[model samples]
Target: MAGLHLAQLNIGRLRYEVGDPRMAEFIDNLAFVNDLAERSPGFVWRYEDDSGSAIETRPFASDPRMAINLSVWDSVEALERFVWQTVHKRFYGRRHEWFERMDERYFVMWWVPAEHRPTVQEAVERLRHLRQHGPSDHAFGWESLPAAQLWKSARCA
Candidate 1:
């Protein structure tokens, strides 16, 4: 558990295009939320492109409107604090206004080596695994195992 980190991937399908007026607020706040994540305690890394955010990256081939966010945190608590206890929470509250409500699971979390930077392919596979197998050490949803057990069980697998 000494060198383990938490890697998380969350995807959402936008109800409108990034430049659409309907999504103006969400688009406007992307950088602020990303900045908050970078400044949060226990923040490690986030996937970004030349524009400094991954909002425009199309990792999911099947859906062009799907936006992917991948990042690593020192612990589950650190990620939680950034997600639920910051300005990002306001955006989260209004997600339904900008993004479609997905029926399938749109996010996954897993343990990775401290230095490992997860790729989009890896995140996609984890999401697929979670969808197909429910919550396991390899890939899980929000109601995941404790970090200690998750690392141990993932190692054993």
Candidate 2:
């Protein structure tokens, strides 16, 4: 038996208050987008609730002004296929239409063992570590996979 690979997710804000009048409409559209993903192919699972949010234990940033949307995915191909191939790619391209280009630190990816979904706090810590240290000895992204794949029986059904 082997552990599953999870896509550690993170998306930052454009401005301080993304829910402001100017951005409210866009934020509201998130529900529609999420709904699309929930039913997307390769969508093993997503973290959200009726309120259209999952919980976050960390401050969006050191200033605490920004916020993050973190979630898990079954695989990099799955997530990338969604983010790039899907309509979602348009929003990502236009993110600067809202968000600031801080650094690579703004978005990151890491691996997690199956059955051990990370908490917001843990995700934050992993991002912080990635910033302080480089990719080695800890986390990596879509471009990197272990020499050996850790495949497991599908729990999807």
Residues 41-77 of candidate 1: C-alpha lDDT, one tens digit per residue = 9999999977788888988788899998999999887
**Residue-by-residue lDDT tens digits, candidate 2, 32-112:** 777777777656556664466642323565654455666666776666666666667666666766666665665556666
Give the TM-scores of the predictions, in the order they appear: 0.90, 0.76
Whole-model Cα lDDT of every candidate shown, in order: 0.84, 0.59
Question: Best candidate, TM-score-wise?
Answer: 1
Q: Pick the candidate with the highest lDDT.
A: 1
Name the lDDT of candidate 2.
0.59
| lDDT score of residue 128 within candidate 2 | 82
Candidate 2 — which residues are off by over 4 angstroms? 54-58, 145-157
